[model samples]
Target: MKKIFTILLLSGSLLVSGCSDWLDVLPKDKQSTDMYWESSEDVEAILAQGYSRLRTCVPYIINWGELRGSSVIVPGRGTKTGLIQNFQVLPSTSTVQWGTFYQVIGMANAVLKYAPTVMDKDASYYESRMNSHLTEAYFLRGLSYLYLVRNFREVPLITEPYVDDAMPNDVAKSSETEILELIRSDVHAALATNAAKETFDGTWATKGRATKWALYALMAETCLWAEDYEECVTYADYLINATAAMRPVFMSTPGQWFNMFYPGNSNESIFEIQYDETNYAQGSGSPSKVFPYGTDVTIDSYMYSEPMTLRLIDEYTQHRGDEISRTYYGSFAGTAYANYPDNGIIWKYSGMGVADREAVRTILDANYIIYRMADVMLMKAEALIRIGGSANWTEALAIINQIRERSELNPRSEVSADNINEATEEMLLEMLLDERDMEFAAEGKRWYDLLRYGKQQNFKYKARFKAIIMENNLTAENKWLSSVLDNDNAWYLPIPAEDIFNNSLLTQNPYYE
Candidate 1:
């Protein structure tokens, strides 16, 4: 089932075949939405298509989520990524489009729209299976909106299926708050159906499909974004106490932690997009070629994109005083670069072998882990601290220490049940932020962490990002990039010209306009 869906999903993701109203086509294979809604198998195929289309956005997700505020530098001057890294993104950058994500939303909406008709057509056949598929659809729609709201801020919220008679192209943007509410409602519907991870067939399906575990992780994440810290802690606590089978245990050993990316679908993964080399002919958009790690000096030729900043590498290895820890530095390497002697390579999701004797080869079947145990653990710690009070702070410290211990970093001492008494809330938050950068570097998370932290600290994140860009510049051409960063709304990329010209209802992000 995993291999079959992986193959079909990649192909279907391209055509998203049956979505007639959205594409304004006859759908060459005659899989038109109206005609295709006649069977449960048809519904399953559409759901599979949704998953396939999602894989298309893996690179965009990483690029948009991490590149903007990250400590990465794209060595070449004219590259699209270099423009993004320098905060000089224009409406024309090819990376500005959001069509792929909306395609996923359209397919998911089709499942939600037609699944009931599927149940009505063959009640006996659908009785046990309908809810599981419906739950998956709801979770996916909610997940799509979560991505949109985080990146785009306010996006059009479309729930109905875009059938032949009802295609609306001029829909206006919904408020971010409104989108969050709809997301919460969709997640609740998914939970009400109560689908278990084991119910999904295939080794990859168990972790790939939307389970109660994934739903709760989404809830905790959404609540954290909404600033409902109490609710965030509640959901995080549920995940922490969840059974091992439902919620995979966090892999603590260094070897397991590093291997988690290559032979993915690990016990630590909550939900990850499945990518198999044989099925995905379009290629996996493997980061290995970009964030490459090897004994070969040839690494310098193709791996210049997003080389980790010396500051980030320094943070990862630096322990107490000026002493550097070899354990933490094990995940990074100094790849030879003609321009710089100390260029750092991120091995986190490089798809390289973790074992000492395993041959280091570039891998294409690198799966993207969207949510994992370590991420939630750190989130739980942040939530507990955000809820305030002395007890919460102490508990939060212990949680952070747990993650640090797993990473083999020095753990904090629990001083008189207060941890660091001199530590203000800002100091505690900074500790958690630094730990996140160390643990999740090159995993497309650091930029968002900086945004969230910046929001918490009076927009200070903007100033920090500007400083990094200015300090790292080698030429005066990109110096003008710092001036654009002065506006608070500059944090979000402008709506692409393609989207704006196509729909008059859509407005460019104000700062960009």
Candidate 2:
């Protein structure tokens, strides 16, 4: 799903496909890009195409080998079979190497370049509609780059539409600092123009597109990763205190919070990749690759592939993944074999059918939300601790407890919003990372969690992970598969080779060599 949809945008993104109005201007440009930019219907086509770009998180995280929030403990996919299988990775065949992100950057470049032009020419109603479309472009672009820099370590920083511009010719990799600046700058641009929050008149537009809070979420993430803790606190503040109607509260239970990823029904979600089960066609976007752990779901259906591990299931059960633990979950993990008492198949595929290990996950209706109310509250808590210091345990612990209570656990006796003392920096860091783990378990936060700690203190997670893996039953060979750090290279992924070849002016990423 990540490789496929990330590239499909240049093919169908804000590029505007099925529109007759755009066809009128067709001959002047292409039949499509031309016909869609001159009229009201043209605005709709761009919007439909723009909204079509709401990319999900499954592709970015799952394929890269981060596990989801299933309470399941298995070797990461990359460690088990995807990236670490051979002593190497696929080059041309791997879209994630570079192509996927470029496509997203391209789509954003084109839409931001064109959406407003059409709005200026169209009617007032068209202008209003295009306003949201422009914002969506901004949000989507930031998302693409966020993953690009995180995974590849750095990227080609494309802000404008791709062209053979003779500017710097400097396609050299930017530092994480520079990349983060790009993200914050883009987010600021979106917030200035996309003042479209609480437009939720029970319309798909509000749900399908990014809200102002979405920008704030991006802002929080950008600052948090950069370790600008106080700034992260401020951004989270915008989301919480902005609108009176939109109260920010983290979901209290794991089922209600985590199950939101099933298909629809994610009220806490700020920006999500909306999927439609009926449109499982390969040409249309379907995320069959990332879902289905234990069920009848087959890889043959909708081009799905990937198998679950007994290891993952056992871990979940060990962690108390039972009906009593999930009072809100309809089908607890224990109910594995309603049909066959002992067979626990793929866990939860978002697609319609449960076939086999290779079935296509032919459903895009399952939305992947990038930000939610829960994330904001939790991030605020982390930032509060960073700013207020160990003495600020009460402020930070309140946020941590909200996430803990959801998992049916009690907060540490020492920390709370009211009766708290101080925390050791290590204790606060551990608490923040641990709470972040539960809050963003399956959402791709784990990889970054490792990186955040790894980059600081000279990549110390190598020793910690080595120690944990030994007790965690991660065999010596398997430990390496999880993308764990090595003393030699720090475990930062190499930049995709293709990116460097295509742009001669760009230098190869620093650490890969």
What C-alpha lDDT values do all the predictions have?
0.65, 0.51
Models, CA RMSD each: 6.1, 6.6
Candidate 1 residue pairs in backbone clash:
none
Residue range 476-497, candidate 2, lDDT tens digits: 3554544533432334445556
For each candidate, give its TM-score against the true structure. Answer: 0.84, 0.74
TM-score of decoy 2: 0.74
The whole-model C-alpha lDDT of candidate 1 against the native structure comes to 0.65
Which candidate tops lDDT? 1
Off by over 4 Å in 2: 1-36, 40-57, 65-81, 84-95, 125-131, 163-170, 200-204, 246-249, 253-255, 279-289, 293-332, 335-365, 413-422, 457-462, 465-484, 487-490
Per-residue C-alpha lDDT of model 1 across residues 15-88, encoded as one tens digit per residue: 33232211221123525555556666667777776876777777777777666644444454556765665566
Global lDDT for candidate 2? 0.51
